[model samples]
Target: MKKNGFKVFIVALMLLSLCFGTLGAQAAYEKTQPQTITVLGTTDIHGNVWGFSYENDKETTNTGMARIATYVEQVRAEQPNVILVDNGDTIQGNIMTDDLYNKREGAHPVMTAMNMLGYDSMTLGNHEFNFGENLITRLQALANFPILSANMSRHDGTMAALPYTIVERAGVKVGIIGLTNPNAPRWDGEKVDSFIYSPVGPACKKVVDIIKNKVDLIVVVAHVGMYPEYDEEFGSDGANKILELCPEIDALLVGHAHSTVSEIIGNTLVGGARNLGREVVRFDITLNTDRQVTSHAVSVIDMAGFEPSQALRSEPFIAKTHQETRDFISGGVTSADGTTSGGIFGKASVDFQPKNEIMGMPEGKLRDTAVMDLINAVQLANSGADVSAAALFSDSSDIPAGDINYGTIFGIYKYDNTLYRVPVTGAELKAYMEWSASCYNQAMPGDLTVSFNPEKPGYLYDMFSGVDYEIDLSKPVGQRIVNLMYKGKPLSDSQKLTLAVNNYRYSSALKAQKLVAATKEWESPNSIRDMLVQYIQENGTIYPKVDNNWKIIGVDFTSPYREQVVKLVNEGKLEVPYAKSLNVNQLKKDGILK
Candidate 1:
């Protein structure tokens, strides 16, 4: 009886001690103010079922989905207030996501994995349209988190189930709204449609009016272009324009461009996780109930940095489900090892960066092959094609300024961009060329701008594949091209020839050639990258500015009215000479060369 009484006393003491410890920790936490709101985010995921492939970089690692779930679990344990968000491109980044949902109609592995992880919110990217509206609606139904978009609406003007959500934490409500890339259906092709993306300004204003005073903070989850090139409607880059236009927004979770921008703009904090499930963005946002900016802290929790999350591992049949879906698409166009001299090379010197980072004008070698060889091969390969051209810039902002890797390849050649053939008159071709050059023009308050940023939403700044041309930004969109030269001679309108471009250019929203509003067109079996990569692989090494595929022959303006084209020279803009050729190393150092 005495021993039993002693044991009970000991248990009581331990329980009391535990309670005291909890109270002490709570008291300490209450005394100090929260530092910042860390917004954990990922973008352009395009369904990275494989998770991050490597340790240091965002390559594929075996940790796979299991690791991601485990990581999220640990993070949640550390800070229960952490809001997990996805910035779009989730539907299409990986073949597993695309191949499964696109090819079959049964289970969605990405959605399943996300639900298991308890993602807070997500936005839509252009690639999401690839599955068409039916699949998206179904996916939305499957997604537990609020799908947000202050901008996107159905064709009939009804909002999707996914609307912006104001997640409340510590008396502060953070309003998160999603906006699809306006050019998604227009630039992507027939695979996507049935939804219209509204401009960021109006869309943001519309949402702001409703949530402004009601919420303490506003966050825009955008998959639109990040940098400022042309203005479709969102103004500059989505974040820049969002901040410029919507001061109410406290932070922006950015994606689409895929460039690394880690800093605060105005009062808002901006952050993004690298492509694939490689990195995780950790954000802890603190706010007052009054809805004005108070304080927030943010970090990109490199997914590779954490051990693969346990949630991903013990997710009760998730691995088996994923394996089933993965094995289903094994026979499709998606396959491992695109092939190379050493490892898997998506393409040769012609690394196709979906964004401007890799195969960019700054990364001169790939840029040279991107335009020159792409155009040259298309022109030469097609006897009837008049001129072949390729566009470099994109509306999406965060193309990584680093070595070309799987993600680089993924970003550069994002779409199932097939070669499109069209017969356009020389006059029509020149008009097209002008459209490309006009991408460089900066619109003043008076001069009208395209409803969208050309390079970003889609490739509006086209460099002729087979012809050399100059831009007279002085002219309108139809008249921008001048001194149209083919092989050093002035171009003739009557020349009967076929022009080639990605299938995306054929869409009615964007004009490329025969594919535009034309019922009849030839779709190449080879991907656009396949041709370019094959050319480089066969040609060995590549040099920039070869054969002078094109030269800036016109408009030299400055600042506001003139083009924002920053010469790479020792100028204050970019450190390098603007036109000098570069390699992967130099390109990485320059970061995202303007």
Candidate 2:
């Protein structure tokens, strides 16, 4: 009986030993099985491949993909398992890329550079649709990596590109899904054609479910950026929504707002690099044997002073193409004898040129500037519409005094918008003007400076040529435009008129409250930039004039105050806390209300 009891005790002890031995082995194996994968991300590159600004016609300190290449190579040397991804907007921003497409007709320079850099995947940005599907197809063929967008579907419900990609690195299976902004249909106008853009949230959820079990780590390379407020209904904030819905996603790299961000929400790490290759986001991820992400680190490397990578500069085809593009852009339109070629601008004189004209008057109000005048004149001349609606695309979009080149043309007109002549009733025109005028913040007494509505973009604040109107700052938006006049007569709501507007603004105006429902009288196949180029070459000189047709009536501002406000605002030093408030007195105290 004692011997049987001893045997039972010994067997029980042996079982206990085996249980602990298994646990110890598992822990030891987990410790030995850690695999690290490095991810490099860039977004909104915008065709700044040479690290130079086409608008300024000079090298920029904080931009370009060439500089990013050097930083990428350094990381590659340190880490053997590195994955590179782009968040789209890789084309259609700089004239260099545009020239390459229009002139060379070969592989796009951006594609060549990205391929040489060994990009694993890229999402489609809204701007990618600007040139239409042909160029997009050509690029896809040239690219060695997958250009993806899960939310982008064809009319027949086919995926436009690969929805997601699973890449293996150092034994880590990483799943990446790409999402684009859903507003592409509206913003890109007819450029998107039959492609349907789904809301980012739903697309991401669908992709995540399919890949969650197949891959150990999930990363979303979204072309959509963080918004001031996340609207679940619109799914505007794609990155955050994915993080919230798909807990399996370990990282979210974003772009499109041109803003930088880094934060951890729940169990995911989110980061966005600024536009123009000014910065890049890198993720150092550690995974265990189970392929579960054990830990990760995020870093944003600024490319301001980094040396250009030899990989980019040493590539003979890329370097030669870049030089050719530089030379082409440097060519400009000038008179044979260096004298102004007479045209409508000849009457306004050289002052009408876009050189130094200020678009906004002092006291933070809209004023007629030659920049808009020239653009409006160009549109009207080309379309022959009764009225022309135009806006300042960029605050620094200035044409230097002497010569106008392709570079200058792009600086003034940023997008590849085409001119359209549309018919509109007087009421609709007034409504359009009102909607534009509402871009200004309500003025308060003692406020010496005028400012735009903080919630609105500068491009949305449009001015009209061939019509006269007054915007009363005291009145609320939608009721601000009063005393509308066209051709020396009181413009009646029922009056039908032909208006010239860009394709982009036409779409935007259609959505404006009570805006004109104009029908298209004519749509030019030639882009507005092409028209401007032709106009400049044919005229050989441009002089623009502002007739002071549109003014801010409620503000008591003059030339001196206008000068001060313009300087401050253009310098990005304009501080108007009451910009969105109706506090005129506070604006006065702040020396902005004049």
Candidate 3:
């Protein structure tokens, strides 16, 4: 009996030891496990640092660096492993950046805000090169973090900037490669003369190959979008090509299309944030002791719920700059070019745009309006081109029947684009017109009103001055521009003319789309916005003058049902038809017409 009892006691002791050993082993493994690393990204901020619109002279709630800063701070407090980055288009937008900071010789406020936000790195967008190389170099010097572009190289064969950066958190190394859009040279003519841009895929692959062995994971921060913007066959400036070429890429953050994206392709995680600081793309990656990724998740956090960080707004230089910008728009400051802006630069005799028949539908694009005429007029006068094309950058853009300030001018023509005079044959011009006319959706039989194509942006629909044309919406897309006349005569296909256009349209639409095969003969020294300001200042008071040269025809809005739908949309009873065209059939399908 004593031997049996001792045997039982020894077995019980062995079991207890085994349990304790297992617990100790589990604790050791937990200690060796890597904590989840958080990567936060922003793109296309466009100089909205304080969440204020200098053009409207009002505070915006939904987007800004200040709001992003608040969210970033909260994340940092919650986790020790966090990295912040921007995907560029940061420096050039708004009157504050383009008119004031960009022309000065001091520290850029956007860079200052970014530095204060603790951005680890930023990829250069095409707009970053809008101002020229000197400004880009200055901005690069001012940023505490690296402003990278792997695809850009100097004419002398030197790298333009650091291609990639290594960020270590929780003993895990993350390799972030930055790629700028390869279309920079095409867009910023003569501005990027000293640099060479290679295809994004090959450039990214080269950088990934160089740093893959040195890091636990590979991430690409590219200024291009996930999909192709133009010329899908080129396939050089998209993130999908990078994914195809370098399958080892663990994650990618893309920009330049101002889109919201979150998806997983193969083994790689892809994410994109909306532009103007409206959202932040975040990735949480968990790695094991062997530095292999075990799990990963991505999310896009909207900044609408987040408060603007006072810490960012109150930064001394930023605060001072903000106040100065306000004062400049109010008409107290003189620009570097010796021009005093703001404080009633001119007067408008009437509202330039007619009221929209349907809410959210821009009447300016449906027909010729004085706003587009003013822009095209300025372009023609400055470039000496026989014909000029200009876009209504904003649907809400107008010259009110009152005083015109710098802000009003900015509202009309938002981008800081210069003028370009390019040669175009009659066939090329007609093709270009056809492309612009394609922004509208075909008017179906039951359609109550003409609607724009949901896939096409309003900025791509240009209005032509110095020509008379009729857009027959009843016809198919490529055949819509009928009765195209120049100087009261039908424009012949073999005629040749010079087209005055902004540099952006010249490159992005004419050259990039292969619609026109002509080089620019002349380029404006100042921005088109600057030229408008000069025109307004010199004229003192501008009158709304619509030549009625262009009109939209053949869309039947005669139905009483059309009137009912329009009334409903205007009275807030029906939602605006933005996703697709609104027609009687669709209304009946939705049970609204019935």
> Candidate 1's error at 201, in angstroms?
1.7
Which runs of model 1 end up more than 4 angstroms from their true locations? 1-38, 52-71, 170-172, 189-193, 225-229, 232-237, 287-294, 310-414, 430-490, 508-594
lDDT of 2 by residue, 168-279 (tens): 8755778999998877766667778789877787789999989888887888998887652225566555666777678767889989888888887788888899889999
CA shift at 301, candidate 1, in angstroms?
A: 4.0
Instruction: Give the local distance difference test score of model 3.
Output: 0.88
Q: What's model 1's lDDT at 42?
A: 72
Best by TM-score: 3
- Write candidate 1's Cα lDDT for 194-235 as tens digits: 566667766777788888877766777877655543354536
Off by over 4 Å in 3: 1-31, 572-575, 586-591
Model 2 / residue 72 / CA error / Å: 0.5
Q: Best candidate, lDDT-wise?
A: 3
Writing each residue's lDDT as its tens digit, candidate 3 over 1-594 gives 999999999999999999999888866665488768899999999999999988778999899999999999999999888989889899988888988888788798899999998999999999998889888889888999988889999988899889999998766788989999888877876788899998899999998889999998888999988877664886897888999999888889999988999998988889998888999999888888888889998899999999999999999999988988888888998775666675778899888889998898888887888898888988899999999999998889988888888889889888888888999988899899999999998877777777788678889999998889999888898999999998989999888999999988887789878899879999898889889989998999899888989888877667778888888999999878654567788889989988
How much is 509 displaced in model 3, in angstroms?
A: 2.7
Looking at candidate 2, the ten consecutive residues that score lowest on lDDT are: 339-348
Q: What is the lDDT of candidate 2?
A: 0.76
What's the TM-score of each model vs. the native? Answer: 0.63, 0.84, 0.90
Cα RMSDs, all models = 10.3, 10.5, 9.5
Residue 16's lDDT within candidate 1 is 95
